[model samples]
Target: MPKNKMKSGTFIAMCVVTVLFIVMPLFLQVSVIRNAIAWILSGLRYQEYKSAYLGLVGGLLGSWLAITGAIYTQRKFDREKEEKRAIEEKRAKEIDKENIKEICREMLWSEIRQNDNSLSCDNGNFIKAIMEKNDCYFYNRDSHRITTDNWNFIIDKVISMDLELAIKLMHLYKYYEFMTDFDGSADSAFTKSQLDFSKYKECYQDVVEYLEFPWAND
Candidate 1:
């Protein structure tokens, strides 16, 4: 047995000896120990018929507490299991989204890298096509619009990922919107010479650099 059990047994034995010898013989001369033992026994037996209901109430209260404790423990375990499952599912989704982002980056950057670097008068058509207020520009027509749907699917996810990249992408979006609005206006010129190309180049580089290569191909 454990030391606590041994100690408890020894203490109980000492208490019994004290009750039988010291309390019975020396301290309680009028048989007080007997009276106390009888009183305890009578209480256990519910002394009178009318008072018996109190014992039943106490028993029912103890049972209700035990049932409550059991329910609480089960609920706690279920909550922990649910939390673990949610965490694992989120991690798996992030991994899948990261893979998709990599593919989109490769396609977008492939076009950006190959295109004209200089902001000369020679690249007017390419610039307007990109900055045009239509589905074609936002869909990345110059890059064959490859994986554009996949790109949209992960955009919010990407914004939540990298701070620098998110800032760059936001600026690029603002510029794109500005160009679209400008192109729609009657005051707009036949040539988009007023637009700055270097600013766009920086945004593209920031986005491309932040994107990771797909695991299978990398």
Candidate 2:
């Protein structure tokens, strides 16, 4: 069962308790309960039975008020805690999306860098162009910042909209993983096959473009 579904039983129990606390006080009017209360307070050191009875009723009223006040405060605390937790979860999700978006922006620029020398830092328009196309910001990097979580998420998203782009990313990730640690592999034993990465980089741009507005395809 879902966490929320199970918690509903607790919520229902609280409602019942609140209703009983409110309505039970009204039942003090019954003659039987009134007799019982008077009998209990009769032995107390008061000037007379009527005085002791009034003292007992006042004490019971005070106790009931305190109990209801405590329940109200506890419910309020629970509500505020749940609201704060929800807000925190939303903020975390937004931050992760931003990280991914920044990474995709960088990858898109890599493909365009060869053609437009202005793709360099001095030119700020490339970022705006990317935003105009898509809003999905997936995180991608060569080192600690790179994670399978976001990579897999983006792959699934792209596969749903563009299967070919997803496949391209799968292959590219193999090399991207290696580049992250070129310092250790600078003296590897054999010469690997050589190939132009231009086509592959261009595919990265396509991936970014598609992700920016995937819903448009719908």
Candidate 3:
């Protein structure tokens, strides 16, 4: 038998022996031994009832402890999971910034390489068309007129003597607003195709050396 079972059996045998030895003699003092035996039996029944009540209380307390522990563990795990997700999202944004920088570098180099003075007016016309399509009007603040002409002007100036003239012209013609639309992916096609930057660091250096622009900080 199991150890607990053996212990319980030994306890029960001792209770039986005590009832026989002690209660039997007490009953002899009474008119009949049967009444003493009945009294002893009633006491045993009361003891069994007390044991059952104590067992129930102990079981309920144990269950409550287990439930409390489980709730605490679950909450801890959820907090850790949320922390990990936040870290991953932050890392993803950093990677995206790096990728955008790389693409912008490549576009700048290509524009420098393929640039021909003969096509300057053509480039200006193309930029004008883009501005008209986007409704980028220079004179009117409310007018939508982001033209290809303005972009061509900036490009030609940058190609000739770097971005000094372009920067001055930009300040004169609301270049900040024009850049806002360009950055918003409004001119995604022109940015991808025409505004090529193959010599990444060199082109960036040219801008930094010559232009006083906000995007240079980026």
| TM-scores, each model vs. reference | 0.43, 0.35, 0.32
Order the candidate numbers by lDDT, best to worst.
2, 1, 3
lDDT for each residue of candidate 2 in 73-170, tens digit (9 for 90 to 100):
67668888999999998897666555555555455444333322322112533223233332242212232222233455566655554456567667
> lDDT of all predictions, in order shown?
0.48, 0.48, 0.44
Q: Which candidate do you rate higher for TM-score, 2 or 3?
A: 2
Model 3, runs deviating above 4 Å? 1-45, 108-218
Off by over 4 Å in 2: 1-54, 111-172, 175-218
lDDT of 3 by residue, 80-178 (tens): 898899999878766654553344344433343222121222444434544434433222222323333334444453434433444543332343233
TM-score for predicted model 1 compared with the true structure: 0.43
Whose lDDT is higher: candidate 2's or candidate 3's? 2
True-structure Cα RMSD, model 1:
12.8
Scanning candidate 3 in windows of ten residues, the lowest lDDT window is 112-121
lDDT of 1 by residue, 34-122 (tens): 57655655656545642465456556555645555455556668778999999998898777657656755765454333332321123
Error of 2 at 37 (Å): 7.0
Question: So what's the TM-score on candidate 2?
Answer: 0.35
Order the candidates by TM-score, highest first — what do you get? 1, 2, 3
